[model samples]
Target chain A: MTRLITILIATTLLAACSTQPTEPDTTLYNRLGGQAGITTIVDNLLFEIGGNETLIGFFADTDIDRFREKLIEQLCEVSDGPCEYTGDSMAQVHADMDIDNRHFDALVTDLITAMTEAGVPTGAQNDLLARLVPMHDEVIHAEEHLNGDER
Target chain B: MPDRKTRLVTLMLTGLLAGPAFGASKILATSGAGSIEGAAGGGLVPWAVIGGYGSDGEWGAAASLGRVDVDDFRLGTASVLAGVHDRLEVSFAQQTLQVEPLDAVIEQHVYGVKTRVAGHLIYGRLPQLSFGLQHKVNQNPAIATDVLGANSASGTDTYIAASKLYLHALFERDLLLNGTLRYTDANQTGLLGFGNSGGEDPQLVGEASVGLFLNPNWAIGAEYRQKPDRLDAVDEDAWRDVFVAWFPNKRVSVVGAYADLGSIALWDDQQGWYLSVQITN
Candidate 1:
């Protein structure tokens, strides 16, 4: 058992060393197929979201065109593409949605589906997801912060 | 007396009836495979996550069947588990060990309960932690008590397990790490009954597993389980396995592995194949 643990530890350390961040400009955006690729990914995401019952209601009142533009911009900005995000903050935009963990997970599933449909490689998909995962609290608890402001 | 099979079928029937009302909420593949002791985990160790797809407010249930074929013996376990509000889990497993030499079988029942104490698997820095207990009853302990001079036909194992998922940790695949510390006196996991020549006191043992999700539907991993040497009749050795698990959807999953059960009773180098399937609501 000790031997097994030692091997696991060694493997983890090796993986950590190998994962030292790659040069930004070359990997993520290129893996995501740059802006054209990002657009395709966003279109596929929209299509996927269109078919999801749990997430459709949230977008019912949204402006599809603007939402598309902002989402593409956000993805591009996060991927460090030569684009600027002109959309509202994640918390500000999602403040009134009453979103929950289940909802967020559903969206994540749809996003994964969208990315998979867009033929994004697993590594790139994971890289992009890592960038976006930190926003979970802001997205789901946006309403709580809004209420806190009121109180 | 209602045999273990009858009890298992009854529980499965009840779960099937009640499952659809409030199940399948969590993301796919989060509810790891079921262990022989009926906890959600790798085949050999219980993980910290509760069984099934229930998230925070939902309920979920699952049933599993597992088998292991070794050089000298064959082992089978059938289990059912329920997850309540994604916090507490209660489970039952019926294990049978077929001793080819003795041309006999030893059957046992394990009732387990685990509660998530703190943290989350994928959310934040803290690994998911849980506390659990498995109360095991050796239905037929003639060989254990009369022949091997075991102390008891029943025992309880308590453990604290922690698990975490590192997203994109290696090769951009998700990696899962689980560790458990258990206090137990059972010999061969109670197939040979509890405590013997080694001592009456339970010993602390360590168990661990590491898995990498190849995708949302498939994962490959390994497990190591330390054992206590309490029986004078034979020396107990640790267990290990290399496994591949497939979670096709929320309803079903399959796990297959190559296992090395070091030694059991008088047998040596008891290496073989292991397979298990779990159906989750």
Candidate 2:
């Protein structure tokens, strides 16, 4: 029993030490190829969305250039880059968009396709998606307040 | 001869394959394949993630059939599982174990339920955590009592599991890690039945899995599951497996593994191949 405890402790310590990255290369922004790469990804994503029939309707009334700028800034900031996002909050921007799960999923799929086309590595794509996932709640139900519905 | 159990499994598979898709969708390969015990995981060990593609406020169901061929034994399993809002899961499985030379067949039924308590696998810092309970009953009690000297023909196992997916974990690949602690008195996962005649207590064991996602749809991993040593008649050892899982689409998945199930029913060094197929909606 004592031997088992000792082994468990040793294993835990080893796992902890192995996963922690040093200060030199811990930020996800650097791994994503910094601001230039992010701009390319965002540009490709907007272009793909613009061509997608199902998603194009959502952006018809919006300013494509301004939206692109805001998205780039948001991605850069969220990935721990030096840029700061000065756009409206996610809830505020999407509050009246009435985006459902299907629309949200379509946009994400387009984004992933764009990233792939931009030569973004799979790991970096997943990391960026992970950071964006937490904003799902704020983005998906922006119209629920007017409908007084709870999901 | 086709039995009632076989017919039920067939019907369940048909239903699962024919069911309409509904609910919020999770990313492909995020919901792992069903374990032999009817929980969502690898071929052998269950992970903390719920089964199927259902996100919050959605419903999903999955069914799988598996076969494991060992040196001296052959095991077949069929299971069906349902997930509610990606928070609670209920599952049922039937296992048939055939012993070589003796040509004896032992059958068991397992019913399981799991609930997600907290956390998310990818979105947050906290690892996904869940609690599960499984009740198992042997169809042939005589074999368990007379041949194996087991105390009971049925038992319950409870477990807590934590799972996490780390993007860019090493060399720019996604890594998935899981840890499980189980409290069980079952002998050979209840194939030999539950408890022991030696008046020993239930054991607490650990299980773990580590996987590398080569892509969004493919994962390669290894799992280790610790078992209890309750029955005095035969020595039981831990189980380990190396597996590859592929998700061609949201509705179909296949997992293949090489398993080392050391010592079962006096048959030592039971190594073999495992295969499973699943359909989900």
Q: For residues B1-281, what per-residue lDDT tens digits would candidate 1 score against the true structure?
A: 34658476557856764566465657778888978888999999999999988777678888888899989999888899899877999999988889998788999999999999998787767899999999999999999988887899999999999999888887788889999999999999999999885556699999999998767788878898999888877878999987889998888899998888988988988988899988887
Candidate 2 on B93-174: residue-level lDDT in tens? 9998988868888899999998889986765579999999989999987877887788898989999999998876754567
Clashing pairs in 2: none
Q: What lDDT would candidate 2 get against the real structure?
A: 0.81
TM-score for candidate 1, residues paired by index: 0.88
Task: Give lDDT per model, in order.
Answer: 0.85, 0.81
Error of 1 at A7 (Å): 13
- What tens-digit string does per-residue lDDT give for candidate 1 at A29-147? 77899988999999998998898776799888899999999999999989888889999888789987887766776677778888888898777888898888778877878877667
CA RMSD for every model? 4.1, 6.1
Best by TM-score: 1
In model 1, where do residues sit more than 4 Å from their true spots? A1-25, A143-151, B1-21, B197-199
